[model samples]
Target: MTRPQLTYRSWATALAALVTAAATALIGPAAPAQAAAVTFTNPLAEQRADPHVYRHTDGYYYLTATVPEYDRIVLRRATTLQGLATATERVIWRRHGSGEMGAHIWAPEIHFIDGRWYVYFAAGRTEDIWAIRPYVLESSAANPLDGPWVERGQLQPARSSFSLDATTFVHNGVRYLAWAEYAGSNSNIYLARAVNPWTYTGTPALIATPTYAWETRGYRVNEGPAVLIRNGRVFMTYSASATDASYAVGLLTAAAGSDLLNPASWSKRATPVLASDGRTGQWGPGHNSFTVAEDGSDVIVYHSRNYERYLGNGYDPLSDPNRRTRIQRVYWNADGTPNFGVPVPDGLTPVRLRSHDLPDRYLRHWEFRARLEPNVTNLADSQFRIVAGLSNASAISLESTNYPGYYLRHRNHQVWVERSDGSALFRQDATFTRRAGLADATKVSLESVNFPGQYVRHRDGLLYLEAVPDAAGRASATFALD
Candidate 1:
């Protein structure tokens, strides 16, 4: 007997009732079904949108998105999928002011190319951050952390009034660039070949358009185009409808060996591969990208607004709607097509894959509090190594020993003990767990690495503070109720 086919729209409502009934229909399961599924919407990071995730060859998954912070690009990488929230982050690069790069940058993508790394992003000039043109940044380092990112300058733009979400793909030894252009005669998902980064000799070909009823929800607009090639097929996934309730994802496909430029080559999938539903409790699940788990399981990463609708007056809960990041596992059908699972709710601990092992080598696994040795210090700009306020020459270096748990600090908010262990204490789901209160640490017993900053869990919220030891030469901490 053959299993029946299901459309993406009905798939979630169906799966949640059957395959995921334990996680969906029943909560705080009487039987606590196994804990694996995509991450529930992160309440802490929910105020964001346009989340992009990529797995680097270095055994780390790097994720970034539009955030309230405009000073620098925030990024984090972790060995495990769940550690992303508390992972170490570095402002790899930043724009000085509000000109071409001075204001409102969106949808930055970091791609590894030709033994080096390059980041492609959309930013508008200071006058209008939304004039939004695609730009590229290059870093020659083996890893992006040891920064010194070199601005490669604006990549070849679409020459239209607005274009963004630039992504590069190599096919048949030829490199191609795909993007969304709204300033042209018409707005659609377009592709062009670049013998190099800045030149495109042929005219752009339109692969997909917003004609389907689902695709034309609020506006006949489609943007944020990303392409994935699998099994001799080119799959172009693009965001359709407006950025609000109308937001959804549409798929375009073409024969692997067909002339990509041929207008008829690419066919719309007829329906959205993903969409939003108030019924499932996850609102606006669109603008997505894909990643592979440590053992190569397909993980879908996307941005979403929580049960919010309408951008109206007075403190809109969805006001900060770049959308927070969410992840879910996806499997291909028997024919090698994509199958996106339903969105997991907030606060639910995801089930770990049966094959995952505890990576405890660094003792980084448990989240802890920390304490810095009393010495000269310059906490800012210098990271963990601090210079004495009285003397610049004398600096103290310390590791982030705090286990990823809760840390109590003096009211001044500076200098306190944190976890020294490498592991994080709280679970990764975005739900703020208020189940058990934190157990205060002994006045002098601190276990985390000290100094620069320590990550502590509070009601499930991760925060950082200055480390201060008691005058009695003792460090203090709080044990996680986690």
Candidate 2:
């Protein structure tokens, strides 16, 4: 497996200090420290949509997305999420010349189940290309990349009408299939118990209908269902409306133990959970799939147009050019619902909050216990979102990615996770001024805006706010944002 390499550089004088620290680490019971990653840009890959990034248990990330031509399925694999950008892509399957899987292929999802691989995708016939239906392709190879896929034929729900976006999940040892189908006038999300990877049993139950204003804009549609099971709940998010700027993501959730086939057991959020953020220039963000970051944090993979305007011919939105693949970290709400933050700006370089003294350690909180631990194997907890403070837009506050809605606020000179109340002290304590480090121009040092001279640093494996010291102290406070 190939992983992204991180390079570390330090001042010649600090090299001796680091060498001494390394020698001490060698003699101790602790493992060698890993270098922190300093940079990665957004729009992970370009000109791809309806992305399904699956992080296999074997330590490789498999990404499959619909090419702009809508003619075939492409697969790419990388050891790191960012590495997927340059990972070699291969077209695994293409549309048949004049048969059922003939034209307008869309939304391909690759899944490994029951020791075999299967791809669930939507396709239409050349005779009636608009009459799209869901189909499956099966591969016998242990590795999906090494596949000579066999056609498992079309998956027909009882009605045999317009159906697409078929997704499968296992709950309580029973496999279930959820997808969008024509419920008379418009498309709506439906659910049915699946007998295996490629087929469903029993009748399909309608779970979500486009009734809200957000769902009905431009067109009444509910498609592209992606399921995420966490915190004793089953969360399923689906795309809605026309495939334009009005497109958005709506959510339906049910308890983990609930009878998934019963539509009454699920509840839909009143509003769209993820939508276009005009401020960020990411329009029509939907058709999202979830994967975990290398650090074990939840990552949301989806497609969005960089520009709002559609460049396609007046008739079909699929001809639009800008629906590129993008990914960002997913945070959980204080109430346990997944929080899909607004689609971030393109070319984004995300940073993790690290301590100056403990160069190998970053801030992480578990059960509200914030501490500094070197080489945190669970890297997601160590990451914090540095956003403008609630009370003061000019000042920045650090929010824990693992524990959402909790900001690092200092009370009595001790930093801890506190509910961001937008208060004067909360803002002041949480607010930090980021400046270039004195030791390295590219490195960063964060100083407390409220405490003035006191900088966030570590001493004896614990973090503290102390008055600035000499050159070595300043060097200890510098951190590289990855």
Candidate 3:
């Protein structure tokens, strides 16, 4: 089904209903839903926007963002996602005092290319703050956080106009650059072939124009283009509308081998793929980047304002200081399009449990029935918040994402989704303890709390509580979290 478009006029009324839905919709079942004790929570850093995070091959997660001050560029490195909250930051570069790049620094992205590190950022001059342009910085130091940065000059497009949020990626052996540009009275996304580290080889192609109602909500915009290439497709996501509660994300897709330079080769989705969810306290979420987690799962890093209203008295929504840097898992649909489930709420983290025997299928309930189906697509439905159960803190309850109040429960040796009744039988029946998998140490087996020795197993394409009597039973009982 197509998602509904968000409009600025209905912000107040929509937010009210969203808050109610969030209060009851737990991302997972009630209990120890947190995957680990040391895991991180959302709103990763306050007053940080246009966030870019990358997991470096050197074994560290490096992050850079536009500071609230907008006067200098800063960098942070952490060994883990949660550790970034307290990781020390260093001022890498400062805005020029009185000329080009003198003020309004915004949307800085760090990339490691050709054995050296570079930072692509947007800035405006002190005299003309709206004449924003893209610039590049080079760091010869092996560690981007270790030394001095050299100015590599501005990245001028074929046409000298207002441009920002420039990102570069290589596809099919060619390098390409994408950014947002001022087109007529609105902003639209444009693409160019990169000649080298700093300039476009030819004229920038007008790739996407904001024509839909969602893209033209408060303002006609299609900025902050972020690219993800997967499943034989090149998916580019851009932020639309105004940077307020009305702000959202729109998607453009093209075949992996298509001519990216041709504007007609790409197609835009009719609706905003990601937008503000008042229930989750994430408003105007956009300007996103992609990364990989420690377990090699796809992760999305973006900035969002927690509150809906504009704090500034002026008409400029860009002055809003509530945009906080955040991160979450990115899932894919069966048709290969990305399914970014709602930006998870602030507290406990969510996880996906994949069957050990059927590696392609993650455990998901269909109409309160548990079964092993291949290529399970919808992320929200497949994800079960695993929290410590009510009966025992160590035991966990599996909550369904689509059916918020329902949990995975076993009855008469069969596993199924049932509503939580807050009873002894319900608590005992819903809770499960993680045990070592019979097949290997890397996988795990879930044992029912009430049914002692019996483990939750997948047999003959169905789930049931049973004893592992043979190799097939052991394999069927094991699972992995991705």
Whole-model alpha-carbon lDDT for candidate 2: 0.75
Clash number for each model = 64, 3, 8
Which lDDT value does model 3 have at 55?
78
Candidate 2: pairs in clash: 38-482, 356-476, 356-477
Candidate 2 vs candidate 3: which has greater lDDT?
3
Candidate 1 residue lDDT tens string, 214-319: 7766567677777677877887788887666657778888888998888799888887777775534566677777777654567777776666564345434323
Question: Candidate 2 residues 1-482, lDDT tens each?
Answer: 12321122124224434433432332222222222332234577667899998887778889998887889998989898877776778989999899688998999998888877889899999898987888999998877888999988788543378888988888888888888998777899998888777778888889889889999877899999999999999999999998888889999999998888888988999898888877567889999899887656788899998877542457456777558888887756546788775776664334465665555676666556567776564545566666665555655667765455677777777667777785687878887776666456556666789888877665555556777578767865676554
Off by over 4 Å in 2: 1-40, 156-159, 310-315, 349-482
Output the number of the lDDT-best candidate: 3
The C-alpha lDDT values of all candidates are 0.53, 0.75, 0.78
lDDT of 3: 0.78
Better candidate number, 1 or 2, judged by lDDT: 2
Give the TM-score ranking, best first.
3, 2, 1
Error of 1 at 64 (Å): 1.8
Number of the predicted model whose TM-score against the real structure is largest: 3
